[model samples]
Target chain A: MIYLDHNATTPVSPQVLQAMMPFFQERFGNASSFCRIGRIARTALEEARASVAACIHASPDEIVFTGSGTEADNLALRGVCRAFHGRKRHVVTSAIEHHAVLKTCEDLEEQGIAVTRLPVDCRGMVDPDQVKNSLTPHTVLISIMAANNETGVIQPIASISRIARSRGILFHTDAVQAFGKIPVSVDDLGIDLMTLSAHKIYGPKGIGALYVRKGSAMAPILTGGSHERGKRAGTENIAAIAGFAQAAELAEKHLAEEAVRLAALRDAFEKEVVQRIARARVNGRDAPRVPNTSSLSFASVDGESVLLHLDLKGICASTGSACATGSPEPSHVMRAMGLSPMDAQSTIRFSLGRDTSQGDLDFTVGVLADAISKLRHISSTA
Target chain B: MAKERGDRDDTGMSSAENEKAQPIQGPVLFYNDTVIDHFTNPRNVGEMEPGEANGYALVGDPACGDQMKLWIRVDSGRITDIRFKSFGCPGAIATSSMATCMARGKTLEEAAELTDDDVVRALGGIPEDKKHCSLLGIMALQKAIDDYLLGRMCAEEGDDLS
Candidate 1:
């Protein structure tokens, strides 16, 4: 099957799988133990941490491994809020954040914290000025995503981070969708905390990392063992961390070339689909988007039906966010982009990756065109 | 259009494929071309001025993010006209269209009783996941009828007042 849902998760790279195979058997020792096997595991884990840090231009001491991107986000948001308890309690974020951030903010709100969800423009972009304007004396942190998972619209993280710094407020970004596909340098972006997931970059699942800059105060969300420098407490996932490092290294090496190629394929797919289909709209067309993603809406066609039809044609794509799949509600990201409810429900997202080819793009455009035409015909008659 | 599975010939093709190819013979849980057509090309969309209509009502939940405004022209307590404006998915639009068709020329009491199941049946059947979309229209229709009755009662009271 041709997979166009790379934003959801990517297949594990061969090099990453190869690097991890040895740890599952030969070096299968607890990193906390005091044996030679344990020492080997500990060394491998620290090396992986360094590689992860290198990918994001962060120091090795700043990285904290977590179970998933969701866990990373939870740790970042909740940990910081708890650490700064009784001082400042207001948090600010964009309306188009992934549920990992949005829902975490909501949970914090239930605990009496004030959350200001800033809206986006028609192209799914949150202006840096809006972030500056929303700040208050009670505001403790500003969490925004580096790139939207659905529309691929890149936010002005560096500008927003600058605004936060000027106000003495901490800045965090959920970079799960941006880390491997785009260039992410924490220092350049002025980010205090960031989230990354392994599965999104062809690494193994159940492993992710949070970047907390040195001397940043953050309380632990999970407290058990003294792992991850007392920032995150749990037994280290040695094999997945090793695989994540290998994948991060490989992704960093080919990031530019793969981005250029995927951008070409994505442009071709969008152009062909728009030319062939009536009322086809590219969401976030006016914004600076990540090269590999495209979100399109076909008028009068239900997104779920389009997804099912595309799946029938052996093309795997998604309608709106993968996190909200199977729910009948339209995407919050599209809604925040000022799209009507019908327009939001009629949208689909196709995210290309390093392995996507010209032939795959051609097949996808042809199949999508046919499916839209068929669905439109059925709609017209009914 | 339910049929006994044992009576049908099964080749190597999967059951889902067979159901897609021949939709009339199986359980109507999945949609056929007829349902897709209504959902895609929904009918009687648009709106009438609120005060000019004999009855009208707007219904939706902001929490759910679905809303609809329905209007009906009543002549002697029978619906002489029906139209709807909905902000929702294709399923909701189709349900509104189907509700309009089902309510035209019916008495206010009859139209108010139109349930989501009735709307789904009129389209031959909607997918289980999308059944809620059909309910939005049903709720709107019921509210419109209630508005019509309340308006009539107010008019009678005005006559008493005068």
Candidate 2:
């Protein structure tokens, strides 16, 4: 019942739900159609675009809506890569990027484009110096995330973006986790291309947007009918798009206060965890991070087991490793930070949301203490 | 949904000692009722005192991230008592618990022959991904039996099982 996995996805807020309801019913006309109802749909779509663009300080015309954040990342990476296909193309990115960007980079490697994966430090930060050193004349794009989904560690995006800008390379950031937790201005951060997802920001799934700076040259990855200014092709999910814009507006309106409140709650939870449980440590504790996330590692215990025990107590959390689900791979972000396999698997992520409270954190820490000790006891003879 | 959120927020009871576990009213996700039952209230969750347990086995490695310590008190060539300590997820714990329950009184030969399939089947069925976890219990039990057989030979030569 205590939902602390906001980094995974957030429930659609009531206001966002309300905003989406009308589009799903009587007003379900295609935005591309030329009829009267279609004109209404087009107007609503443009308004939503403007709302999202305003939240991130980009022009509405620069935004192109996509199916999801993953698609947007693909659009940014592959669009540019495909445009410069058959050239001496290369990309620079960090090891701690989300799978959306990482896997896309991997796929690019298969297609003969070179990818330089920079490693993060123990604090889960990608150094700007490393980004600068990795760049070459062949490096056409540099993609780094604004914040990590697991550790919530904020990357030195502005510094890295500055490097890319000075070198005349396209810079892209997956801001799916960072959009609401931190201020994400495309111009201010010097991002030429960016990916944004709705589900992580308390909006409906299957709707996202990409910000392409004016004059940023890239080919359309999705080809067909002319939509999203011919950059992406598909009939838009009007309801989800409307919900996304409303969610972005909501996040902009309350960004400062909610960021402060969630950070307080997250820190209190972390402090209580370390005090009550032996060997309980926070991952990326020294890094500048987003406000709502806490990644904790309990030594000598497996994270999947702890997650199971917490689930029994009606507390929702996530583990870094997918071992329990038949995937033995621990988080690449954790591994890239030089944690032992066991340490990586022992990590858990707790992401706070609007509904989280001091009391909720108190109860969660209490449950966590129980789960940790029980698991440790199960492993150790006493 | 509202009621569940309210229950989580009823966290005003700040004292952990006073926090009574509200019985789970909803179906546990992924796992069936049987797996949930054994994991929630796992049986035989302890170690045998030294000199009392003749057979012991530890399966899985910490690097692999899941392990169990199982002990058996064999008598007259029949398993008289069994206990286990496990550091694993629900599937590992549940299947191990069920294995111990199934092996408590079985003869040494019968216990050693118990398969991972039997433990999994005993739990109704685990998820396809977690089906591999059942091997931890069955492997540990067979290893304990092997340890017992090895100890009897070494006991006549004056040695102890670690």
Top-DockQ structure, candidate number? 2
Q: State the lDDT of candidate 2 residue by residue for A296-332, as single tens digits.
A: 9887777877888888889988986222234656778
The two-chain DockQ for each candidate, comma-separated, is: 0.11, 0.33
Clashing pairs in 2: none
lDDT of 1 at B109: 78
TM-score of chain A of each: 0.98, 0.98
Candidate 1 displacement at residue A234 in angstroms: 1.3
| TM-score, every prediction | 0.78, 0.90
Alpha-carbon lDDT, every model? 0.84, 0.85
Off by over 4 Å in 2: A321-326, A380-382, B1-29, B61-64, B154-162
What is chain B's TM-score across the candidates, in the order shown?
0.77, 0.76
lDDT by residue (tens digit), candidate 1, A125-220: 999998999999999899999999999999999999999999989999999999888899999999999999999999999999999999887999
Q: For each prediction, how big is the interface RMSD?
A: 6.2, 2.6
| Candidate 1 error regions (>4 Å) | A380-382, B1-162
Tell how far residue A235 is off in model 1, in angstroms: 0.9
Q: Which 10-residue window in model 2 chain A sums to the lowest lDDT?
A: A320-329
